[model samples]
Target: MIVMDSKAQLTVDIIAKVAEHKMTIVNAAKLLNKSRRTIERYLQQYLKVGIQFVVHRNTGKAPVNKTPDSLKRQVQALIKEKYFDVNLLHLAELLEVNEHILVKRETLRSWAHNIHHVKRAKRRRAKARKRRERMESPGLLLQMDGSPHRWFGDKKSCLIAMIDDATSEVHAEFFPSETTVGCLKVMRDCIESKGLFKALYVDRAGIFGGPKRCNFSQMQRACEELGIEIIFANSPQGKGRVERAFNTFQDRLVPELRLNNIKDMASANAYLKHVFIPQFWQSQIQVKAKDRASEFTPLPTHINLDDICVIKEHRKIRNDHTFSYGNKLYLIDSPLKYSIANQKIEVRNTSKKGFTAYFAARRLQVSEVVETSKFDTEELEIQKKLDVLALAEKLGNISEASRLSGVSRDTIYRHLKLVKEGGADALKRQETPNLRHKNCVDLDVEKTVINFSLEHPHLGQQKVALQLNARYGLDISPNGVRGIWLREKMNTTALRVEKSLSLLKTA
Candidate 1:
């Protein structure tokens, strides 16, 4: 039997049937189990559709004494003049509270529509075509993304999210910053907690891969060692699931952080781990259990998380009871009195800064630890920039500061404007006073040229200018020697270059 929960719809159906059968309202009500007044109303509506005698009595009735055109214009003008950006609901409340003008929600919606007409509403672009869902098994494809957001209400933080392709369950915590180390830690946690995913999907970041010109980056090399395959998205659209999840998080997660009063990454991580994850899983997730049954293969429990998270290096104990690690020396306290020099040992760098020595998977004591100093100007620059940035963050005037110390206010402001998007590292200076050298096999001719230039004070440049096409059968200028001497003087302690080179007797 055909059934409808709505009585109004049933009445409409009776009216439709009565009109079709060319029956009177009284007869229609007798057949349809409705009151005569209801039948009369139905007959009236039926007749309005050109069925003459059965027209609805209220067909052209005024809409509850209609919202006057003048009042609508007043509301719209008030919006454009004073509250253009006010949302519809708020605007409606404002009209009721301020103007003593009550409005239907639909009427307010109509005002919005008219405003669009006046404002030349932006045309809606065609939505992107929906992609076909390609389902992968659990632990097959892990989507990894760094969501840099205000995880804590007080400050911004980044959470390195690793979600299972099948289950959409996150694997780790909120991070202080979005860095390769943070990602590595998250991935390590995932592997130790959920076992290795078949492949990892990530954006085209340096931490995942490099630009076309560069070879496989350090991150790619690290992934290769872990036996995890990497997949990179060419566009954000390709990673829509995580992008959509981020949108949801921006709305809900921020409010949650506010509620929890999360102020830093550590607290946010605790919330994520202890409270949010469980609640979210229960409320939002729908997992298809193994084999159509409500059962799951519990994650393996034997995997040691620490073993995979650390960087291990093999070293040899030297005769001095010290071992070298990436060239840094660590003194080991072996029970044997003699040095185990040239003997193999293992050095492991866990989460901590200090070196942990292990002899065949067993921990050993280190007597002393020391690191070698290497000439890395780039490393020094990076460290200096880090310190500068940290200080800049402390002092609110970093935005007004410039690379050149004590720069003019105008210049500093101009540079800051230019480098607003660029970070503190952008405001660095390079060393100058470049020099070059060239050699010829003619000693006598060179000495002759040199001696002549040294003796002539004012004519050195002029003679060199003229000797450009006739210098010992070479097209060389005397300014070349002057340039060389000037450059050499900058680096040498010798008071006089002419006196020092005087010892080189002419051949």
Candidate 2:
């Protein structure tokens, strides 16, 4: 009749047996793995208070240091309403600092699991990783990485971030996609604010150093010029700190963005810098080093950050002191302009400042030519079309060209058609507006198509189109559905084929 756990019930039975002279106190002590005095105490309690006395005195009573139910409820309410996405450890710190309610991470986790039924999916067991020691001071090393995630619900974005190896302080900016420009901007912002770090620890992404055999990428070249050493991680685990930061961002940042209604990269970047980062640091997630002195070096007086951080390309200055970049001719002017004719010059272009020409460490005045002759425009347009076609030809497919250039297959086809009919000049000609045709489907329909393709992955274009027509009452051609699938990079057949081949190999 005792409503108790197995251990408690066993203790009650043993006490009853000892009291009835069936079991000796010494034998009961041995059975219960307790001292003789403890066994005697339990028997005495049973004699005084009956079978209920066998239960521990603390049973059905809260501990002296137990958090109040009201406080626990307040913490749960705050977590659900405001800090729903924060991890348990961070939530505990936030509760103590912000809400003045002290709680351990384990306690918070237990409360959340029992009261709120909050659960996280178990991650796959990873290989054993060797832990890397953090640097002793800030700026000794900076770990840099890019995380491409659905920061905004509407679209995916790449967050280029750099974190101090010692302090774990992070500086990140959201970009449309990870590129050299984004990396440069993130590094520039970091350096301008915190000074230059000794070295950068980054992955061997194409934007960074790329393959060992290839020439230095723009980012690598810029880092070399700035006297910053680039250390490439042999594996993702080597840069675990930055990778873990990205994990936190995926967990917390997305929900914060949703709550704040941040839809664009600009707004997301601002929120990340001004709000989330500050709050994150305040949560005391980053541990402070013993030595507070920073190892970051100040910018040299002779060095120009703009020049070091820009995208530099070598071009030959024409006889007229003009150089063409991106199909546009730019004229370089200087006191020694005539002397500099036919000389190889470096064209430095930045996102903020347009373009500047430099030769042998000397900056030259550059201006874009607004006026273009008909023959020149025709020639440039031809060259541009030929370049696009050449890239497509090199890749051996329009899909690769579209992926690399961020151009649509339709545009590539249109350009190729123009090249076939009227040569390169045809590509330069303005397209007449098609007033009759309008988009049959909106963004919602496009999202629906994408979702359906993901859910019913084996369904082909024709079936998908038919399903959409039946479900949404919107008639869409098979080709239209195919285009949508292509844009989303959802080639289910190829994926299924690859998966089958992998399974076969395993078998």
Candidate 3:
């Protein structure tokens, strides 16, 4: 006699046919390509048809203990209000300690969907694309991005961040917009603090490179003056280092901000400089320096970083031992003050209050007294109106007046008196938008190089040159393009290997 689960009656049916036919068990086994014993067991299940027939064999054992309900609830709450990007294991650890629950990971994961009520947001992964793998030595290449998040925890301001590709160190500042001015400020800060990098790698956003114009932008000119190469990624993936860094920052940084209770940009930046950065770099970033020597070299002594980084102007002391800055007259208290009227002096303005005045390195004490003048007050109001109109016009809007002079409505309001007194010339002293750079490259060469790189990322100079000549119309030497790309800091990734190899040999 054979016996089997009734739920498997279909297989038993076939076995019953052979048994009902009085066929030998060997014959049934041969027909089904199964063991004789297996067929016999199915034959017995068919005979017992009245009750207990359709049960699964393994249904009775209880499942392993599940994660506690209270623990799951707490994790769900933390994820809902904080640490949205933290992964499963990190969450598990937090739950075990913070919620005082020791739960198995498998059990915890089983309840994840039910607890959270939503699937985790999928993080963007960089897709593999056909492009040259470019990298540079530490401090050689820097990547920049603008994050328009409420970084200060008060929903207040947007921050622009610049990170070193080799070390993942950040130089960030809060800005009103992700504009060229914001980018230039970050760049100026980096250059002043770290000296000139070999090149800067940035996205092809409008702020970074203008409308693909033939001429260089004012920002580009400033970078060129510093001998810093400006390189634009062909696509966002090319600037993946900075993009991914921001993702990680969005994860861990928010909690840090909450812990410190940072509610404003000034306090947040101060925390970043003092508490956050030192701990972050030590914990996360890998050292990619060539050797034991420190990668960052100090800035040159002669270069006054403060002077280069700041927006400055030349002024002369007036007859009343006073000087004017942005329409405010500040009286100077000089020890030898008979009268220093018409003497040339320098004024340095920063984003913060308190402008510094100097005469050839001599600090001049500014009088705290408020001086009121009719002409000064009038000029101030005129400037204010012009600024408002200028800002409105920049957004591609119209002024109240019917004119295509690109003047803002606020500008019209600011210079309404000025326009009544003078003309459009009163409002036009040259309105520059504090732009500092532009993108410049030979289109033909760029195409040839980019195409060759797509085919062979690790191609040597000679091989790339041959491909360029054979396929593209360019007849340039391999060394020529190689020099150009290297000079621009675009090929630093490949150069790092050679540097690493050299270091290994020395070691």
Candidate 4:
């Protein structure tokens, strides 16, 4: 029996007719758009092999270049195991780089669909975006942004990233939340790894630019000192490169993390640095620059990243070589060669490192003043309580005041009674309570807690409790020690709120 396509069957019938002399070979060749010689060959084949000769010899045979079944199975297993959530193109790239199996993205897509029933829905049509040309060289400009996403599992983290506008190479780090420090850290990482870029293109977020009224932000200040320009995008669309990169990350990185069973920022970041980033760089996401030369400038030996990337505040040094910040006193360790007494000095504070004082661009040694006596703590607590009551009274609502000040309503009422009895001065001069709860730790321990908190403002209640137990042999519940710093107005959250209010007022 002959197995052939309709065109082949028609040609065979014509050739058989020609063989029978029913039609001229010339006319049959004309009908099939072939030469007379070709028609003669078809006729001879048909006469020799019967109907089977009409079918092509290699009709049912696999092509010589067909992918092997073993290779297909390997691809299938890899798709199921590692690249389960990755897109077809990215998966193909991963296979080529990591598994040494080169395949077209379309071919991989078809095979995946046939073997694993993987299907991709058509995307909705979007407005045509304007084309933006890439920069001529790497590190000319970097687009920076923060993507708040559930990158691991239930907890949402901010992936602060910076990508070169030319090469599309990215440097990103996961933070518990997006803040000035997170942005600073991302930029710092990029600079440390790839050298300092010429400029940073970012959104006009509060961290990049202060509230509408302010002239500059911490980022702007740091950038100015580092000799890097800060360009604020008029809109999110203006910095679409970073935004699009974020979309890809959310689509691919999330599932990659899920498959790896990564559930926290530390593990996610480790995987990102070690595995994911290297593979992604090998992928099609990054583009090669026209010029291979980098626009990033090498850092000078004298420049200290720790000093540059920090929150700076000016304080006047006391005659005794001491200064106060956030209600904590710091004394200079050694007598200054040239006294900076009563002169303003810059106090630089970093999240990782505690605090450092600088006068005339010279770093100074300083130590925190630790209060050892219980009487001093009791007196300080009384002053703090009075300050809270005064703030509450100024706000004109007890509940609002309690919420803002982190004080209990009952405590507010009792303080109000004292204020009524002897005015605000009485509240200020109020005596410490005689009896304390069993949960109350020693006054020295409380001072230590305050010092720890001031030094490490980012530490949470649980971490603070852990540090206390580890360092000082003092066991205290997190809640028991949660609001001790709040009373002293030393908590980072409260300080942030105050900072925001000040900015609003300025605006």
Write down the lDDT of every candidate, Cα atoms only: 0.63, 0.83, 0.65, 0.82
Give per-residue lDDT, candidate 3, residue 238.
83
Model 4 compared with the native: what TM-score? Answer: 0.59
Q: What is candidate 3's lDDT per residue for 331-357, written digit by digit as tens?
A: 887675355678888886666655788
If scored against the real structure, what TM-score would every candidate get? Answer: 0.44, 0.60, 0.51, 0.59
Say what the RMSD of model 3 is.
Answer: 27.1
lDDT of residue 275 for candidate 1? 77
Residues 24-62, model 4: lDDT tens digits: 988998899998888888888888987677677788899
Give the range where candidate 2 is weakest over 10 consecutive residues by summed lDDT: 432-441
Q: C-alpha displacement of 202 in model 3, angstroms?
A: 3.6
Which segments of candidate 4 are over 4 A away from where they belong? Answer: 1-5, 59-74, 77-82, 93-107, 115-130, 192-196, 210-215, 247-264, 274-295, 300-303, 313-347, 356-507
- Give me the displacement of residue 280 in model 2, in angstroms: 3.1
Query: Least lDDT summed over 10 consecutive residues: which range in candidate 1?
Result: 289-298
lDDT agreement of model 3 with the native: 0.65
Ranking by TM-score: 2, 4, 3, 1
Residue 205's lDDT within candidate 4 is 82
- Greater TM-score among 1 and 4 belongs to 4
Quote the positional error of residue 290 for candidate 4 in Å. Answer: 4.2
**Mind giving the per-residue lDDT tens digits that candidate 1 earns over 1-507?**
223456546566667777687677787778778798977765775677533333345666877878889998988888777556455655676678667888898888888787783323246775676684634467766778888886666667887777765666767567777776778788877765656666778888877775741646545655676667888887776776666667556545665666556787677778777776787644575365243321123434664545545555678777777876655566777576555678787665655776678876667888647456785887686565555544454665654443434445564454455347665555555464342123532455445554555544335444654764464555455555555446435212242444445645652
Worst 10 residues of 3 by lDDT: 433-442
lDDT of 3 at 157: 63
